[model samples]
Target: MNKVLFFAHLRDAVGEESLEVEAGGKTVAELKAELAGKYDLPRLETVMTAINEEFAANDEVIQDGDVIAFIPPVSGG
Candidate 1:
């Protein structure tokens, strides 16, 4: 299982700071699509993804025990 973390509005969307998923062998984009559909999340294409605290590309493959975090775009004046 992989630990998926949500930030900002993404966290609110998931209603939790983090959740575990059976994501090993899946790409970041694949997981994002699954979560978006499952949770009805929005604008996931614009969200940044991080694996094990380091920024990752959509094609990056997830591994068992990896920690994934999805962070939405932040705007401020």
Candidate 2:
């Protein structure tokens, strides 16, 4: 299982800061698809992804115990 973290408005949308998902051997893109479908979140496409505290590519494979964080775009003045 992978630990998926949602930050900013994403956490509010999902109603949770983190969730555990079975995504071992799946790519980040696949996980995104899963989340979008499950949560009805279309904005997920614009979020940045990190795996285990390091930025990860969409094609990066997920492993068990990995921490996946979805960071929504932020705006500042």
Most accurate candidate by TM-score: 1
The lDDT per prediction is 0.94, 0.89
The top-ranked prediction according to lDDT is 1
Q: In candidate 2, what are the lDDT values of residues 23-71, reduced to their tens digit?
A: 8999999999999989887577789899998889999999999999997
Give me the displacement of residue 15 in model 2, in angstroms: 0.1
- Candidate 2 ranges beyond 4 A from true positions: none
Candidate 1 accuracy as TM-score: 0.93
Clashing pairs in 1: none
Put down candidate 1 lDDT per residue, 1-77, tens digits, no spaces: 99999988999888999998999999999999999999999899899999999999999999999999997886868
Cα distance off (Å), candidate 2, residue 59: 0.3
Model 2 CA lDDT for position 71 = 76
